[model samples]
Target: MTRKLLLVLLFLMAVEMNAQKGESNFSLGFNYGFGSEFSNRNYMFTNQFYKVQLYYRLKETKHFQYQILVQPEINFAEHQLLNFYFVKPDTPNYQQKRDEFTRLKDIREYVLNCGFLVRKPIGKTCSFYVLGSIGPMITDTETERMSKGFAFADVLAVGFAASYDKFKFDIRPSVRHVSNAGLGSSNAGYNTKNIEFGISCQL
Candidate 1:
């Protein structure tokens, strides 16, 4: 009887010690979404592709913390109907060549962003918040020089997330919209949007 009683006491003490250790919170997540860009007052007849994003956050209080993100995208374009005007060169085929050059077959857009996110945990470790960022963007097409270049793209973003936590494991699904204003001169202006669902583990 004494041996059994001692075993129960040891189990209870171990449980109590573990409970007093508190929760160590670290979260990593990923997101992928369908997105497009808005430019020239019209939806460019380009099929926006999916972007892969990664997120990391650390809890400071119960409501606020620090967050960072990395996003990379691949784009496939649809045929566009556009008119091209050119200065008549000292040759006969200047306008003809310009017309052919203006029509593109394929294009790709790449962007890298780094910024901060703010959160308000509603009840538990799950929260909703807005994200804003700034970074550089590069656009390239398989056709001409006027169609491919790198520019500084500013990232202004806002999104919401739902998170589930099981001790050191977490799963989060989120949606966000990112806008590109302009670069120095090569303005590939568009609103890139995405929706992502991902799972992560905290060590």
Candidate 2:
């Protein structure tokens, strides 16, 4: 009788360990948000952009976890003025200016970023975290005949995240500030402000 009881206990322990190993708590989600970008010479509001993320957490101690995020965004503006400058060798006002056609054009851009995220769990299903990342960005721009080349845009972003979870639904909000590394003119300076909301679930 004692031998039968011991065998039963061993079997139960093995089954529990296997169940934990097979548990699924990983998730992938999407983000939608709005923000604005400003340069030394130009400023504009960005339209809504899309974000994709992959996350993983431990079943026992959810405190330590990591995530990877990718984002492709768009910026919009109208009636933006482009300033022109000219330099003459012998004149007091070496820089001349031209006020030509004033029309609206949409600047197309693509961004690829990878972020490393760390989280600390709060209650039964809540956590606070922070992320740091850097990536490459490209912009399509139109220039006059005497122009040198197309403008380039560099991007870097860092921020914090807060997550609340109930059952299978999760709501995550993040705030970040991005620094634009000038890609075109020598004096080009760029910066942007951003706030994003993310939603995800486990399947």
lDDT of 2 by residue, 1-203 (tens): 33464365446545555666664444556766655554534333344566554444433343566655444344442223343442224534334312331234454444555566666666656666666655554445432211223333343443334445423333343443432344443323234556667776542
Report the lDDT tens digits of candidate 1 across residue range 1-203.
33464365446545654665664233333444444444443224445455444445644675576666554555555433243433237535767755665665566666665667776666665656667766665666422222356654454555454555542222333333322343232233444544444454442
Candidate 1 residue spans exceeding 4 A from truth: 1-26, 39-52, 77-98, 101-104, 142-147, 166-185, 192-199
Model 2: residues with Cα > 4 Å off, grouped in runs: 1-21, 24-26, 38-42, 56-63, 72-104, 142-189
Cα displacement (Å) at residue 190, model 1:
2.9
- What TM-score should be assigned to candidate 2? 0.55
Among all windows of ten consecutive residues in candidate 2, which has the lowest summed lDDT?
143-152
